[model samples]
Target chain A: MSDVRAEAIELRDAVVLYGAHPALTGASVRIGRGEIVLVEGANGSGKSTLLRACAGLKPLVRGEGRVLGFDLRHERAEVRRRTALLAHRDGLWADLTALENVQVWARLAGAAPDEAAAALGRMGIAGPLASRRVGSMSAGQKRRCALACVVVRRAEVWLLDEPHSALDAQGRDDLDALLVAARAAGATVVVASHDTERVAAFADRRIVLSGGRVA
Target chain B: MTEPLATARTIAAKDLAVERRSRVVANQVLPFAGLVMVMFAFALDDDAIASRVAGGLVWLAALLALLVTVQRSFAVDAADGALEAIRAAGADMRGVFLGKVAALAVQLLVLEAVLVAAAIVLYRVSVRDPLLLVAVLVAATAGLAAVGCIYGGVVAGAGGRETLLPLLLMPVAAPVLIGATRATESAFASGGATPAEGWPWVGLLAAFAAVFLVAGAMSFAALVEE
Candidate 1:
């Protein structure tokens, strides 16, 4: 088996569509280890769709791409197993406490949290609310809990879709530091965002998207 | 960081623990399942119909209970951003699907136990072969939960989860329901485990579970992101 550590996400003429509506044109790029790439575009400009394509979340209904050497069409599971994606909604269980929420993803990500509290602590989520149900959390707090998921899993690649949204200044700084730490650890990072100012310091290159085409 | 079994177990455990703490399953689902069964019993009361429909009654209770629980399964994960995180962390969607199915399976078993116990007490329905009946329960419940897990993903993405869930789930679930009801009827009629007569229906339920599970697990990542 090739070392998973050495792998990178590669996109070549990758196209994605929702029925007849094209979300990504024949776009191509490669993201390598230790690289922090920023995907900047207006809403519905294919920033999210690009991340989805490379992660094998979006099907390459036409054209082709390789993520960590697995063809997006034939080996999606292999591609997905090596990539981590964060999205806009902070998709979480409102009924679960912040700690339980992260623990669930940690388990699903094949990471066991000996102490979920410790993970929460690292994400700057402490005190009584750490155990509070997600439904009661502020958007920033929920995003913090969502960020804790990456810490627990510690995957090689991170595809963050608007990771800085709904955060106050402190939360943005914390996330920036987290992204820096991830890159220092040799993890590949990609951030898709319209808020370029918040993510600028961490990017190795900025790929701009407009009208489903790379600009 | 952990083995897949441990990971799946933890995901299942977290959901189970949270539900236990909140008593959501007991408060919301258990009563509803029991009520559905009792309603059926009352509708079929004081007639030879109760005994005739007992098998269908059990299958019906399981189907309804599983349908309700499956939506809860995805709703919990989707709410916490846990689904996106799991997908991001590159956890096998199959493993995640299995974890969801496993959690729902446990919930279904508990609901089934309550309903079955209630059936015996309230309706005076009795199984001639307790062990064989337990086997039937296990097979049929697995079938229901497996199909439910897949449609749960589809319903999670739809606009109306509560309305859409049963719509998507029932069509896929019909084969298993029919098989389980037929197997139960045969069991009741024969008063024994008759493989020649009962196995085909049981086999159909088993096949439905196997086929959908593989298809569901394989197609899960696609469905969730869409």
Candidate 2:
């Protein structure tokens, strides 16, 4: 495979701005295919922005980027189709049950309902919990449901921001297992989180961001 | 079904399902519209004047309720970053726009039915032609929903979306209000008007609906993305 195809994510001098302030200032990064990479940063350090840039949710104002061989600036929709980003917000319909939320996302991703239910089951949300409305679920439960959504997406690239926050011990372990399984299956994973000790053992490499640049 | 059409159907169905569970339209918006009609009845105490102005009053109430319904519709998606998630999932943006418009149109149609019933009873107005009235309702609702979705998406996640939506939507929706009111007036045959006079206005409403729907679908991706 060519170098571009060998690397799951490649960024060169990428700059992403929120208004006039630069969230990612001329940052460059590379992660090989099937690698589990952890991105560490302090508050306002642009960790989330880096993950979003890889997911094609944020546009690069000044540099070149490619995820899974699709150019970030020109092929954002293609990148988005092959990647999933789990951010701080659960991204769920509050009025719908957990099962319904995952099913809707599954259908949107062209996955079967059975796959959605199985994802939820893997996240430890089953039976009554799956049937309960997301609005009433505890924060950790909601996070698990959101993870279920990420699971059902079946993307080639996983861009997760703070994937561990709001999860119980079991949920955290489940998430870690999920990440390991994803890497084993050849899905590249980029996670931005402050909880390094938890992810350090399994992460293939670690990169830190300071003031929007790789440090 | 084609992928885009199927995606649109799923989005529309999901929206309707959320609305059903939340009951925001049924419990809140519908009651608010009914109250507006009631207030109009009280303000225009004279039966003849109320009947004559019923068409304008009904459409006016719908316009105000359109603002509320659209706000509620977008709020559901904005509340938990659902729209962002869907967009990042690479679901078709045009499909998303159409689904939202379809859901909003369905809710607005139901609201219009209630408003018309309230108008007939409260204003003591008689319908000259039911078919004309139905055409006016469908076309007018489509225009309202299309415009509402466009402006709603524009302000979906903004800090001042509540006030911003009305400010952005009301001025642009003036044509819809005028067209619907005039067409409805003819439908009721008030002031010596006839159903034939409303057909042209229905055409205008449909045109407005088509233009806004196309524009909204094409621009929805940019509007929702950062």
Candidate 3:
């Protein structure tokens, strides 16, 4: 968005292992800032694994990476602080009001309360709905709330796994618009999903995974 | 740069708020603590329990309640990846550790108070040195909460964290239990200001707390990552 194309993510032969098994195998990928990339693969094919690695949620077994200029190996915390990862789990506290979930996270990230409320409004969750516990909400609503957290965080990069799973048509469209808007605001977006048809309209690149490597 | 305590305070607020809303401690752990203490009363009769085991019973009940509350704290956070959100925010994992310890400590303190009240009422345990008892209560519960929170994180995602936590925590907690019970016994013997007599045990509790607090804070980021 700033007319600056910088390397936002750089992974060089990065290996990620879970116990004795390898989840990602020497996969190398580069993504520039302000870009929206879709990671596509079947279950256990390392789509989520790669996103987590980039999020600093998972460790690399071998090779190297740098996220937003921080070494993935040594300064993973710095990368994590700058990114938001919406994993398969919605990550919202079921007992907390939807608004509390967003605001607490926003405040934790040092964002203003107004920004949290605005993020909730952007996700179509305000008023009474915002005060309701997340456990009582529908699956789609929970996903939306989680998305609100990601948005409210104001992080530099967003790593989402199957963000469209439970959303309806309208929700899906809202997400597409939100992702595009986020990119326009200069945030890099990497969404892992198999349903490329739904997100391809806004995705700048489509990277496929096979056998843990970027195929 | 954000204030270090800012995120920790936010985390503590969120956790405490959730507990308040859910009443998990009120409806579940408090009752569990009461039930355990009540059963202790039933098992040993009034005289045998009151004179011999009141302090140990209270300590044991608080420990059980601490175990449950600590695990529950992590469970709620881990439920929807809230823990991961905290981590990814890079919002001072040490704060995350301290925040959780603070929440669990508060809940455990409440449980201790309830257990103490129950001990006084049910067991007729006289308070000669309520001061020493109170000191042992606070220091030992702090140690228990800190240790429980750390192990709670360690087993957060494990296959059998539920069972693993107690085994891992209780042994480490034995010193706290022993020191607390011994100190309380001494205070009961000496009466007011008798806590000075058990200062050595109190020191042990404080040392245990410092060890685990530092360890938990340092390692929490790694524990929750997986």
Candidate 4:
């Protein structure tokens, strides 16, 4: 154990499985505050499994991990509160406008309006589009709405899976800026991306998953 | 307590907003109740029979209102991705359930009043005691929403919800409907069976509400995450 003083996420020989097959086997990683970590692997290679475990979405089938000092097995809710998980599902109300989506999440995450709006606006997602129904928005724009959800939340850790999949060049640039800012503000951000070009640009460190363990 | 209440309020407000946007309660429920009332009028063609049974008719309308509304309330959450969002947001499912129950309770109350009023007008029925009627409405609506919220959460993730929802719900809600209608009829007949005589059934309804509310909260986490 290399005792890092400000470790945000620490997974120790953690194993997670879906039914019979193990997704993560003896996987161990430590992420420190203010670090931008990238998790990369092929499909079915446990990238998402690791991210889901770290975010407290899926329980570890074996071993131990701690998020924000809350044991993954015991203090699940505590870990969930301090971390935000954004998956392929935008998790926004399609009937709700972008601002309403952010506002709903902000309240759920116990964030203030001014802070949330500033976070969304900083990413250049603002104005009338904020109030337009997400169902009415384009794919890239909906992705931006999901991004705004993460920014508005006051979590110290973010587990994002393929956040840049549908974004355009400007959208990617904006996301990169947001990730950098999130890291700069002492939030441990773990992004799972198959896109090497984008990961190379913003990732502070990269962990590659082969088989079911970190390669 | 404050956070849980705030979370509950937020959940309630979000559901209300969606309902408002789509005019689900106002548009879908009112017309559905009206249709049921018209059907009940034709189903019981005897004016004397209809007048004598107006309370049960209205209570039946309320149950159908619950059937129509609770499923859609949860379906809306599932459709709008609100359920997944709430889970991802770390909300207490109990609070979320209570919030949904609260919203549904209010909507059910409004719909129940509509049913009661529409039944009175359409069937030319008279009320012996209005306040007692409202009390029955409150107790019955609470029970309905509580049970319906759980079934709603259950069916929210299942396939063929249209077929599964009623199949799962009717058996569970049958007791509530029987108890509510019996309580309402006894009260309306000016019989000695006061709301107190019906207290046991009311207590059953309240206890049932408590059980479902807790179960809804605990099970909600698993359901939404699924």
Task: Enumerate clash totals for all models, in the order shown.
Answer: 10, 0, 1, 0
| Model 4 complex DockQ against the native | 0.51
lDDT of 1 by residue, B1-226 (tens): 3455665676677768767766767899888888888788778776466766777777788888787788777777776456655665556567667777787888888887787677666666666656556666777788787788888887775788999889888987888878877777666553343534666777777777788778877887677765
Q: Candidate 2 chain B — worst ten consecutive residues by lDDT sum? A: B1-10
DockQ of each: 0.45, 0.66, 0.73, 0.51
On a 0 to 1 TM-score scale, where does candidate 2 land against the true structure? 0.97
Cα displacement (Å) at residue A148, model 3 = 0.7
The candidate scoring highest on DockQ is 3
For model 4, the superposed segments whose C-alpha errors exceed 4 Å read A1-6, B190-204, B214-219, B222-226
Clashing residue pairs found in predicted model 4: none
Docking class of 3: medium
| lDDT string, candidate 4, A1-215, tens digits | 21236478888889998658899988988887778999998999999888878878778878899987778887777777778888877777877788888888878777776765676686567888777888898888888888888887767889998999789999888899888988888788999998867877878899999877889
Considering every candidate listed, which one attains the maximal TM-score?
2
Q: A1-215, model 2: which lDDT tens digit per residue?
A: 22345479999999999778999999999999999999998999999989888889889999999987888999999888888999889999999999999999898988977998999999999999899999999999999999999999998889999999999999999999999999998889999988998899899999999999999
Greater-TM-score candidate between 1 and 3: 3
lDDT of 3 by residue, A69-184 (tens): 88788888788888889988888899988999888878887788888778988888889999999999999999999999999888899998999989998888888999999999
Better of 2 and 4 by TM-score: 2
Off by over 4 Å in 3: A1-6, B1-3, B46-49, B190-196
i-RMSD values for every candidate model? 3.0, 2.2, 1.5, 2.4
Candidate 3, backbone clash total: 1
Question: What is the per-candidate TM-score for chain B?
Answer: 0.89, 0.98, 0.93, 0.89
Best by lDDT: 2
Query: Which 10-residue window of candidate 3 chain B scores lowest in summed lDDT?
Result: B186-195
Which pairs, if any, clash in model 1?
A84-B88, A85-B88, A90-B81, A91-B80, A91-B81, A92-B79, A92-B80, A92-B81, A93-B79, A93-B80
